[model samples]
Target chain A: MYKIFLTFILSILLLPYSSTFAVEVDMLIPPSDFQAFDTPNDDGKSVTLRWPSSPSESTEAEYVVYASLRKNGPFTTEVLRINSKTMYEEGSDSNFHYVEIKPGKFFNKDSDVTGGRSSYFFRLVMMSNSENVTVNEIASATPKGNWFNWKKLNNFIILIAFSTLVLWFIEHAKKNPNLYLRKISGLDAIDDALGRATEMGKPVLYVHGLNGMGSISTIAAVNILGRIAIRVAEYDTTLKVSNIDPIVLSVSQEVVKESYLEAGRPDAYVEDNVFMAASEQFPYVAAVSGIMIREKTAANFFMGYFYAESLILAETGASTGAIQIAATDSYTQLPFFITTCDYTLIGEELYAASAYLSREPLLLGSLRAQDIAKGIIITALVVGAALATIGIGFISFIFKAS
Target chain B: MNFFKRTIPLIIAFIMGIMMAFQYYVPHEASQSLLKVVTRWGITIAGFAVFIGAYSLFHLHWNKIKRKVPGWGYSTFVFFGAGITIIFGLYNGGEFFLHDKQEGTMFDWMYFNVQVPAGATMFSILAFFMASAAYRTFRARTSEATILLIAAVIVMLGRVPVGALIWEFLPPIADWIMSVPNMAAKRGILIGVSIGAIATSLRIIFGIERAYLGGGD
Candidate 1:
């Protein structure tokens, strides 16, 4: 009984040295400058383990990183198993081999990773031919989450400066609401189109192209729609609005309804006038094409973002002898619209539609702010090109984000 | 009444606008989680929006059918198409097809065999339309159009093998045009669009633009 008790005590005492003693051959040496530290700029789920490549390591040798919650308890989990060849392939320098330790699906209380709060013990074992040849001392690190991404600081600064410019312009415009904006001919001809629709005793068809509610062009289209709705209501001319998105359809209904109310012609507002044509791309084009042919709309307004369907819609409208005006920010689809429609709003012109139509000082102010921002961007580009030509690449580098 | 109709919505827009705008800068796990949650919420709302789309579609067609409009016959096809697609989807292509597991549901077969071909046909028609548009565009009616015509020719040639046979230098010139002048023009427009988008977003965020809320203000 005494011998058994002594054996138990010795076993408890030598538990730490068992890993060292269990090595069959001391052919390997522990890597120098071993470290375990929190991985920077990431969620607290991982820590980076680093060690300088050891001279004794060969292509055949394997690196085994054993992890445990306790400092000296059993390191049951083999967190990593990689050969020295792969570690060397990552970098030719004898500097460091890095392994980011993150827990997988089966991790539990023993791993003790409470999102950077837990400090887990990690020890390395160098093995060859399935035998432990060397062992490294345990080190601990806590994986942490950072509050801010320093990389996006440049973008943040630009956004802040631009916003400040907009607000300043908007404030200035309130006092002096006559912000000079170039006349967009497409928007200018809207009244004539409406007048023609009324004269011809035919409906005015408005198609919001294939864009979601979140798109800037779509919002601009909606704003334009509101203005058109008011004019149509007052003129007592029928206006049909076709939609591809349900949200846009819902919003259009409300916008048209309110426009009718504002025009004091709530009775003339038809719920079915604004409806979802189709959700899919080709279906939407097909439906809108059918509307153009069947209604024989005197005037057609195709606005927002478009894809391949731009031509089909415009061509069908053109065939019906309607005066068509198309506006979109999609540069790729501009050629098609320009060819088929009577007038096309290109690039930034589409964005200026609402401001021009509403003639609201606040909206015009935003437009002016955008123009000023564009001037700044143009100057920056010029300077950047000059500097790059002269071998002063600092400006270009500053603009480049990681 | 004004508060509920206008002010409340503006307040909500303000909160959402500020949150999403600044969320781009935050790298924390909590910030990422918030973005994911908000994105999921948007998707969930879009799922419910399907019903709104159906309501408008059915209402439009039903009106046309009821009134016996000129194209009323076509309107009925929309119903039959939707009904057939749904029924085929629910049956799962007979679900075991005499106790043998079929490759896919009838929905998949219908999509591939019927919808895909139909979509492809519509897409194919764009080529003819493109040719027509190209014919109109390539006409050198003005000085600007002449320049456009020349540029378009170069790009078209550069994309094909025959251009190299015509002149070895032609390909390089075309490449230079695309890489430098074309890229510069595209970037210029993109910058303007981005700035416009940002300004519009700010206008909405600050409650200066109420057109989207149907001009309740």
Candidate 2:
């Protein structure tokens, strides 16, 4: 009887251990609703997995995802490990979990999809700290591709609308060709500055800031250059165009040449008049500053986009007592131009300067369309603010970038 | 000649611009691949274009030196700088830029010790320029100038410890000025810039603006 009592006590101590090992009590339960499918709006290289809510935060089981090329075979290939507490995040589905399976290299080597659409088999595993584990059944899903990104549909719609507006305006302007544009003070000074340079018998220095042809500011500056070149050619005044970008220099040369030809003064065109000053930023500024000082130009037109070098150029030009007119879309540099130069084109005025100078139907049309678009945007902003204040917040989602 | 110089470029520009613009909305792998291909093409073309810049720079200096023009001595420095940089760069084991450039060479030494410091020095000069500019801007010559000066002083004070020492409300006032008024003005300019950019882009894509392609009808 004593021996039986000792055995009972020993069995009680080992009962928890034996039951855990022998009976195979699962440390974690496989979450329900576990399934896999194709990932949307991707390049066909990813799959997505979904499952029901995690068991409990108190349970220290980690959700391990396994992917296989075949169904019902060795499901040992691991994919991802998700914490149980992650599923309990605020606003997230308290009853559901979803994970995207981007099987890049692993499935490329061991995938089991046949001649049919490419498919992958996936399963969920719940593992505890004690090294005990449980798994859900395998589910198959296909990874697919789509042509258009529906997420960016709003952006696409805006682009189409704006393009149509611009084209329509261009057609209208072509028919009428008498569209009115507001006076840009800096542009107004352009002809006066060129004429002043002629009267003074000193060159007009046109400095294209350190931007390449890709920049819209540089393009606008070059257009303005064309107009200025025409005036320079007509007035029989020397014009100097300094550039930091080789491509811009090439284009400037051609533009100036064409302008001179159009002015019926082709013989007056000089290739050296437009040349690359320097490639590096500070060096370019230094070189142009040196030119301004040495030549003592009568007029200086600082156009295109500028960075910190703006102040240095404008300051040096101011010291030279040149009739300076500045135009740029870089608003940060506007204050410098406004303070030092005789006149400054702020923001959109720089873009509009080309249209205003050329008075071309196509460009003026585009500029007019831009003004209309700005009005629409302002209206949208006011409406959006009112809607948001009134508790309708979905309007903001329309403007959100995907 | 006109066709090669003008029409072909316009056609190519239109096709490329339209393709690139619309490609932003495509999620397919082919669209991405096309972008990569086009980017590589652009880089290659720009690589070839660099020679043009180098040629123009050298030709300008050469003409200056030939003419014995005033300040001709400065033109010689350009040649010296370019020559030294190129020679050392090649010496740094790039196989004349055919292979990877190794470190601990004269090229790296010149770039780190010379170019970097000079560039930094040039940038540092902007502080003095800013001070002078601020002085000019803060002068209360008009009603507008007075308002600007007050705002500048408030912002300057609120940003430092002395501001809190002077007045507790100063910081909040400065914050309001930056967050509300400053942000509003900046956003207005940004909106204008965006719309103007779109207008300019459309003009180029449609071949309406030909000045950038060297001024034509």
**Which number leads on lDDT?**
1
DockQ of each candidate, alpha-carbon based? 0.57, 0.64
* Residue range B1-217, candidate 2, lDDT tens digits: 8898788988998999999887887767788899999989867877777888898889989999999999999999999999999998877655566668887788988889998888888888878888887888789999999998999899989989989899998999999999999989889998898888888878878888877655446
Interface RMSD of each: 1.5, 1.7
Clashing residue pairs, backbone N/CA/C < 3 A, model 2: none
Q: In model 1, how large is the Cα lDDT of residue A157?
A: 81
Q: How closely does chain A match the true chain A in each prediction, as TM-score?
A: 0.80, 0.82
RMSD for each model, in Å, please?
Answer: 9.6, 4.8
Off by over 4 Å in 1: A1-34, A49-66, A72-101, A104-106, A109-116, A121-139, B94-103
| Candidate 2: fraction of native contacts reproduced | 0.62
Model 1 error, position A387 (Å):
1.8
Off by over 4 Å in 2: A1-30, A52-63, A73-77, A81-101, A107-117, A126-128, A131-139, B93-98
Give per-residue CA lDDT, model 1, range A1-402, as digits (tens): 999999999999998777564433454666765678887766667788887776656677788888877789588788889886565415547556887878433257454645546777788887777556445568888777787667777777888999999999988999999888887889889999999999999999999978888788999889889888899998999999999999999999999999898889999999999999999999888889988898899999998999989988898898899999998889888878888999898888877787788888888888888999999988988999998899988887566774
